[model samples]
Target: MALDPAPPMLEPPAGDEVARLRRMAQRQWAARRDLERRLHDGAALRVSALTLRLGLLSHLHPDEARDLRTAVEGIQDELHLVLQELRDIAGRLYPPLLDEAGLGPALREAAGRCAVPVRIDAPDERFGPDVEGAVYFAVLGCLSDGAATPVEVVIRRQADVLRVLVSGVDACDAGTIHDGVRLLGGTVALGESPAGDALITVRIPCV
Candidate 1:
């Protein structure tokens, strides 16, 4: 029997396609920046001010009797919890250290917040803001997946590419990470390590 002819192959994308992709990347970055600005300058600041005002209620009646003082203490405790939650939200929106310090410190701070212990090995080298932001958030999503497995993260630079490896955490937001990396003209691979640990590898060009 004669085999049918194969389907025609598609041509590679041209300059227009590349330009469209660049525009998409710029939009994504602009959205992230807007979110960070709103959280830092709007919601976070309001929450902090509210927390301070609630705390000052105790100082307003410092000479009150024991029972009143006890009531004020309870309110202060609740406000403290609310402040913690607000800080967590701010962290999720955009980690301050990620912008101020860099990727390494940001990852370490994120690891410290995880329920399971995480060991991170990252170089001091810095990349562009968009590149570092994408890499850091990818690992952050993995760590925030509510898994109890200990995590190990290693970040390094290979020539003009920045490499990030995350293992031992399940349920990472691989799809989201892939979208972000794609915008940066990068690649992401997810699989198991030799010892069966959940592994995620991301590579983004530093050009």
Candidate 2:
């Protein structure tokens, strides 16, 4: 029998496909690494800076501390904001709470940070902490939809489960939102109701 012909070499991806993929991967990896850093190094840096600033302010003369105090005070404020932002970003990076705080409070906090009106309907008592972080990101995704449309977050407590309803936004990004939900073995379903903005619905298992 004739020897089998050698397999042809596959042509490499042309133009920017390779470059685009490389860039995309870089961005994703960088973002993941940054979040990990934030959760660890970022937290450490913020705490250290805040501690040092507070110690300095405690010893300064009122006159000196006045300007330094103001500056330090400003830094302190930014530090607090950064802490919150970092928590959100890092959680968005890799939620620390799904394994720590669960589904209810995390979502509530996400709702609180929104400029758009946010209504959080949570259980009278805490649900599984594993689920809260996922819920937090799910709500975050809904709010991020249009960035301009105000969003309402309704977290309903059902029999050992949680249902999330989001409305008043045109942009609905469910993949990211679902990833958050799935972090705790929860699932999400997306839809929109007319009249004005969009609506997104998510469901999760919480006990």
| Backbone collisions counted per model | 0, 8
Regions more than 4 Å wrong, model 1: 1-27, 30-38, 41-63, 115-117, 146-150, 169-176, 190-199
Q: What TM-score would each prediction reach against the true structure?
A: 0.69, 0.51
Give the lowest summed-lDDT range of ten residues in model 2. Answer: 125-134
lDDT per residue (tens digit) for residues 1-207 in model 2: 899996775775554454554345445544664566667675757676776768677566676866777777777777778777766676666555433444555566666667777666665565533444446656666675546665666778789677877777544466777666554445666666665556677777555
- Candidate 2, position 57, lDDT: 73
lDDT at 72, model 2: 76
| lDDT tens per residue, model 1, 1-207 | 998996675864576566577567757655665687787788767766876776577667767756666876677677668767766765666667877788889999888878898999998876766787778877777777776777888898999888888788773566767876787777888888887986888888776
TM match of model 1 to true structure = 0.69
Worst 10 residues of 1 by lDDT: 11-20
lDDT of each: 0.76, 0.62
